[model samples]
Target: MTGAVVAGAVVGGTAVLGGCAASPTAPPSATARADVTRVTVRLDDADALDDVVAATWALGVEALREGEDDDGTVVSPSSLLTALAMLGEGAGDGHAPFDAALGAVGDERTDAVNALLAALARYEGDPALVAADKLPVVPMLHTAQQIVVDDDATPQRAFLDRLAAGYGAGVVVDDLATRSDALDEFARTHTGGLVPTSPITPDPNLVAVLQDAVVLAAAWKTPFDVALSGDQPFTVVGERVLVPTMEGEFDTAAVSADGWQAVRLPYRDDLVADLYLPPEGSAAADDPSAAEPTTLAGLSTALDDAAADRVLVRLPTIDLESTTDLMTLLAGLGIVGADLTGVVEGSAVQAVQQAVLQVDEEGTRAAAVTSVGVTESLRMPPPNQVVLDRPFLMVVRDTTTGWPVFLAEVLDPRAG
Candidate 1:
C-alpha cells in the first residue's frame, strides 16, 4: 500500500553462508502413504516460535516470487511457540529466558538479512529494482533444533510429535505413516482450509533425527473470492488472450519510468506483494533477446522513480502451483561460503551428514506449496487505471526486512 518511501541504499558488500544443494539429476520416484492419528503438542518459548514463523514466511515469500501459488499462508509466530511449549516435557516458565537468549542474537539477524537480500537480487525482473532511491529493510532471523525420543516407537513418530508440538495452537498432526506423510499432515493441519501438500522422501534411518522443517502462514485479513474474478484480455509478447481478472481499490505506491510501472501491493494481513508492468513498445516487449540480460538492479531504479503515487488497481485473479529446489536458489543468493554438502550442516537435526552428502547418497528432497487469490472491486475511482494481465513478477516479502524468500513469475494465469 501507499507509504513513505524510505531512501537508504543497501551496502554493496557481500558475504557467503552455507546451505543445502540438490543434485543435477532428478531423484527416483517413490510412492508411499501413511495415515496416523492426530496429536497435540507445544513449544517451550515465544521467541523460538517467532523465529520459526518468520522463517516460514520468508520461505513462502521466495516461493511466491518463484511462481508457486497453492493457497496456504505460512504459520504465525505465536502459534508456533505455543505448539513447541506443549511438546517440551517439563518446560515451565523458562520460556522468558529462552526468548532473551534469542533476542540477544543481533549479529545472526544481520547476517540473515544480508544473505536474503543477496538472494533477492538474483531475481531477473524485480520491480523494486526500478525505484530511484532504494530502501534497505532488515529482518531478524533465527533457528532452533530439538530431538524427540520414544524407545518403543518408530522414528517417524518422533518427527511427527515434534512437528505437532511446534505448531502450538490452531493445528493438529494426523495420519502420519512415513516422514513425508508427517510433513503433509503438518501442512494440512495448520492451513485454515484444505490445501495440497508438497511431496518429500526421507531416508528411513535419518527420519527420526532429520525432521522436515515446518512452516505456517496466515493470509491477509481480507481475502478475494474466486467467483468474483472474471476473464479479461491481456497482451504478452504481441499475443492477446482472455485472462481471469480481479479489480479492487488498494492503497499502493507505484513507480513509473519511460515505459513501465511498478506497484507495491501491501495486504492487510501484513504481507507485501510487488508487481511490474512494461509500457507499450518497451524493450521488454520489443526485443526478446534484450529481456534476458535485464537485471533487477536496473528495474529497482525505475521503480524508485515511478513509485511516488497511487492508482486504481485492476489485476487478474491468478491461481498457480510450482516447485523449487532450495539449493540452486540459495547458491544464486551467494550462500556458497560454508560446506553445505551434508544434511547436518543445513538441517536442525544433528544426526544426518551435511545436505551435500545426503544428496550424494540418499538425495535431497525439499519443496514448497503456495496459493494466492486477489479480486478487485470498482466501487471507488482514482485518477489512473492500472490493469495487470501480462507476464509479470510478484514476490511476498517480510515487513521487517525487504528480503524475499519466495519468488515466481505469472507466466500464464490460465494454465494449470
Candidate 2:
C-alpha cells in the first residue's frame, strides 16, 4: 500500500487544503538511520509553558462540546495534543492550523510541546504496578509515542529528529498491511490493557503512522467508604435512572459561581480531579443540548480562591470507554489538508482516538490512545453536601502545570 492510498482511505473524499503545499525539503542523508529507538529528549521546561497548557485545555473543552449528546464521554487532551504536536512539526509551512489550535506560533509550538512533554515526563513510570480498584499510594502516569513506518520507507531525518527532541518518539518499521497485531500489542502494553486494540488499522498503503498513548492510575487522598456505596436514581438528559453511587466527607476546595458549583479532589503527585455541577434547573443541567459549563480557567480559579473545609460528597462509580473519529473534531479546528512533506512526500493526515476511564471508591484509572495515520486527533469535589445526581463535567489534570489529561461529561454513569 502507498501513503496516498492509506491516507485516502482514512479521509474519504475530504478535500486537501491548497497553499504552499508540501515543501520540497531535502531527504535524509544516505547515512541517516531509519531505525531510531526511543531516547530521552531533554528540553527546557519553561518554554511556552502557559500557552501549551491553555491550548490543551481548550482542546478538552472542544471535545466536551462535540460529545454533548452522548450519555457520557471522555477525552485526553494531553494524548491528542501530543499526537498533534508530532504531526504539526511535520506540517512545514502548513503549520498554520496547528499553530492556531495549539496557541503557539512559528517555532514556539515546538518549544511548547517539548516543555509540555518534559513536565508530564516527570511522572512516567510502570503502569503494571498501578491498582485500579484502590487508591494507589504511588500514582502512575505512563506515556509512549511511536512512528510506525513501512519497512521500505525512510521517514525524513529532520522530522524524526524533531519527534525525538520534542516527544521522545521511537520509530517502528513493519509491514503496515500485516503487522496490525504489533500495533495492538503496543496499545495494550502502553495502556495496561485498558484499551486492548490500536485505533489505527494496519494498511499496506501507509508510509508512517504517528501514535501517542497515556495511562493514569491514581488514588484519591481520601477514599470513600465502600459500605456507603449504593444504587440510586441519577438524572440523565432529564430522565432518571439507577446507578451505583458513593458518599463521603472530606476537606477539599470548592466554590459556587455563575450558576455552577465546582470542587477539587486531590490525587497523588499533585494531580487533581475538578468536578463542575451546573445549578439545578439551569439550561445545562436540564437539557444536554445546552452543554455550556464554566470554563477550565473559571473552575480552576474558583477552586483556588475557595478554602478547604469538610463537606459531604456523593458521586457515582464510573466506567467509560470511547473511540472517537478525531477528524470530525479537527474539521471544526480547520486542520484539513495538512502539509506533511516533512514526514513523507505527498502525504496528508487523518486520525482517531480510543479512551477508557474508571472511577471507584478507591480512586481512578484512565487510559487513552491517540493515533494519527496522518490522522489524528476530573473531579471534583465538594464537601458541603454536593450530590452529583445530575449531569456534570470532570477534569483530571496535573496541578504543577494545569494540563488536563482526561475530561469527561457524566450525564449518566450507566452509559460508557
Candidate 3:
C-alpha cells in the first residue's frame, strides 16, 4: 500500500500506478506523509522495462545452479529487489557493483523499481486487484514488507524513513541477540502465511534485516479444465515420468522461433506465468548462455518471435518447493562480492530464498520469501496445442512491472 502514491490522471483499461485508482484509498501514515514526495512520480510504461526482470532471471539462474537437482525451481526477484533496493538505498547509488546487480544505474534504476512497486501498492487490500472473479478458481493474494533491526544496533533514521516511504517497508527493532522467534512470526504474517518457517537466524554482529515478500494464489486467466486433467507422461533425462496433467485451450501470448516454443499464462492480477521449451540440442535447452532461453531477456523476444494466439495447452500439475542459499551463487555471479562496509561494517550477509509453487486445473498458489542474513535472493502460449511433456522452463512475473516473481526448470514434475 505504501508504494501506490503516484500523482497523475488515471490510465484506463490498465490500472494507474500513480496517485489513485478505483480501489479504496487511505491517507499516508503519519510516518509516510513526510516522504509522500517520493511517490508523486509517473511510470508511463514499466512492462517494457526489462531491468528488474533481467536481473531477476539472472538471480534465478543462480538458484538453478544451487539446486542442481530437478525438483522444479522457483525464485522471487521482487522480494530480492525490495531487499536489495533497501541495501542499495543504504549503500548509496554510486556503488557500481550494486548498481549493476539491480540492473539499474543512478536514479533510473531506483525509479524503475519504484514504478513497479508503486503499481503493486495500488492493488493492496483491494479484492478486485488481488482476487480474480470466478474464471474457474480464485487465487488468494499476499504481499508484505518488514524490516527487523537488532536491538543492539542503531541505524540512521533517514535511511529507515526512505525505505518505508518508497518501499512501504515496516521497521522493527528486535532482539536478534536472544529472541529470534519473533522474526519468524513476523515473516509468516507478512507473507500471509505462505512462509511459515523462518529462513533467518540471529547474528550478534548483524545490524539490520530488510525484507519483502509476494504470495499469490490466483487462477490462471485461462484455467485448465479440471475434468480433462489426468495422468500423463513427461519426458526427463533418463526416463519419462507420469504425472497429473492439466489441459485447456487458452487465448494468450505464445511464440515459436528458430529453436524453441514459448507461451504466457496470465494470472488474474498484474502478474503472469510463462513457459519455455527448447528444441532438442538447441542453445536454449542444451547450452544456456547469455541468451539462455529462460532468462527474462530471452523471453522479451516473445512478441517478435512468438505472437499471441489460441493454443491447446496440456501441462503437468506440479507442487514444487525449494530452498536456495544464494550467498555462494551470488558470489559466483559476482553480485554479492561488493564491499559494503560503509553502510554496515564488516557486514556478513547471506541470502536464503524459499519458494513454493502449485499448479493444477484451478490456479497457481505460489509464494516466495527472501531473507538477507545478508542473504538474498512463465508463460505461455499456444492455441497451437503445445504439450509440455518434455523438459522445459517456467517463469512468473508481473505483466505491467515485468518483475519476475518465480522462475524454474522442470526436468521432472514428480521430483516433489
Which candidate should be chosen as best, given lDDT against the real structure? Answer: 2
Which one wins by lDDT: 2 or 3? 2
Q: Which tens-of-lDDT digit does each residue in 235-272 have in candidate 3?
A: 77646778778888877777766667777887665556
Ranking by TM-score: 2, 3, 1
> What does the lDDT read for residue 166 in candidate 1?
32
Q: Locate the minimum summed-lDDT window of 10 residues in model 1.
A: 353-362
Task: Report the C-alpha lDDT of model 1 over 46-102, residue by residue, as the tens digit.
Answer: 223344334433333332333233321111121122222222211122223323322
Per-candidate TM-scores read: 0.45, 0.84, 0.80
Kindly list the per-residue Cα lDDT of model 2 for residues 1-416, writing each as its tens digit.
11100000010111111112121232222212334433443445456767877888777667656553366777788777777777787787777788889878756677766666566666666655343334455566656666665555666788887776656666665555445544666676676667677766544456666767677777787888999899878987668898999888888887777777778878766778888787788767753325442365667766866889877788998887766666777776766566666666534455566666788887887776666664211245543767788888778877777777788778778874
Kindly report which residue stretches of model 3 are placed more than 4 angstroms away from their true locations once superposed. Answer: 1-40, 45-50, 92-94, 126-142, 283-296, 300-308, 333-337, 375-383
lDDT of 2 at 192: 65
**How high is the lDDT of residue 197 in model 1?**
45
Selected candidate, larger TM-score, 2 vs 3: 2
